[model samples]
Target: MKKIDRNNLKTFKDFLIVEGEKVNIVFSTAKYDRSFNRNNDEGLKNIESLKVDFNVNEVVYLHQIHSDNVFVFNNNAKEFIEREGDAIVTNKENVIIGAFTADCVPVVLVDEVEGVIAAIHSGWKGTFNSITKKSIEKMIQEYGTRIENIKVYIGPHIRQCCYEVSEELKERFLDKTKIDENELFNGRNLSMERCILEDLRSLKIEEDNIYTINLCTYCEEEIKLFSYRKSVGTYGRLFTFAYKK
Candidate 1:
């Protein structure tokens, strides 16, 4: 896969390609706030710029509630509004589906063979509930996506270096993921990456097919990514999306 790194966005080419058809996996930086709730003129203008930049007909974003619900968009005319779920999957073309996040993990899953794509907003709750596995299962059941053919991309988020959680939360995550506490924890700081990797590997997803950007959203400065922890709950969200052409 080819990676195009820019000042405000990161694009992965060929990661979701099939038979010369290409899909762009984009992760926006803080410079481009793509929050879905913004209704100001500037917000509309920003969305318009995104449309022009990606050459997509529509942009479907989620109303994330930190749940494990995965909504499937089948291109129905009435399903045009913001979907209420933490993950979204679709097989339609020309519509870019995205998830909004500040400190939560932004994941994009692509079944290159089936031409199916999914976006997941996985926080502690979503991760504990095995949202990624559910989304993959949904794709397999609904869109004929095979586990072996799926490619996973994990974007920037709060990592273990600074993600200090309570003892109860840490224990719950450890129990759910069944990861060794020593490997998944640095003191009270839990490694979301390790838990996610363990869960993915348990589903028999190949390690090579999984790609992680490995940037910590809470402390990164180069790209100026928004971090919920860093901003104390008042922060602009970063938009990560996948668009196929």
Candidate 2:
């Protein structure tokens, strides 16, 4: 099998790509490209630069609301519809499907055999509502994706070390997962990554197929990743994108 040519682009970090597969999974850093501040003109330029670098015809994303809703892209759609959802899936080639996050988990799911991919934004609210699980289920239902054939990459987010939560939120997670309160929450913080992984495994995704970048946005200030908890006044958001060539 041909090996995947990992791009060492200064703007983004290539997270996961299978040998001989047409798909590419990548997440932007605070390095050369700083599209995190999406409110200004520079942010728009950064996004355009990313599309150029990735060589995708268009970058499709959602106006995320931390909901469990997943939208499937229609290749023939005229203008990109600004939908309020948390996930996006598409079998359409050469178009980047993505999500923006500050401290929320950004997940990219790929079924190489079926040439289908999905991008998910799972914050505490979305994870609580089982958004990742719902997105995978939608992929299987609509695109005939096999659970075993799917590869998942969970990107940078706020980990338990830096993600402090209220007592009520902690109790809600405990009640939902039925895990012991102490096990789920380390003192006052909750690991959203753990909750996401548990949900993925519960959906029958193989443990080995799931991968995580393990970088905490809130903790890694030197990396300069956008963190909502760290700085909420900024309108910056990290853009994670995936596309099938």
Best candidate (score: lDDT): 2
Off-target runs (Cα >4 Å) in candidate 2 are 1-20, 37-39, 76-78
Q: What is the lDDT of residue 28 in candidate 1?
A: 73
How accurate locally is residue 124 in candidate 1, as Cα lDDT from 0 to 100? 86
Q: Per-residue lDDT tens digits of candidate 1, residues 110-219?
A: 88788999989999888888888899999999998888998888888899999999999887877777788889999899887777777788889977788777678899
**Positional deviation of residue 113's Cα in model 1 after best superposition, in angstroms:** 0.9
Kindly report which residue stretches of model 1 are placed more than 4 angstroms away from their true locations once superposed: 1-21, 32-45, 76-80
lDDT of model 2, residue 214:
60
**lDDT by candidate, in order shown:** 0.76, 0.79
Candidate 2 per-residue lDDT over residues 44-141, each given as its tens digit? 67666666777778778777788999999976433543678989999999898888888999998999999999999999999899899998999999
Using all chains and alpha carbons, the TM-scores for the candidates as numbered come to: 0.87, 0.88
Candidate 2, overall lDDT? 0.79
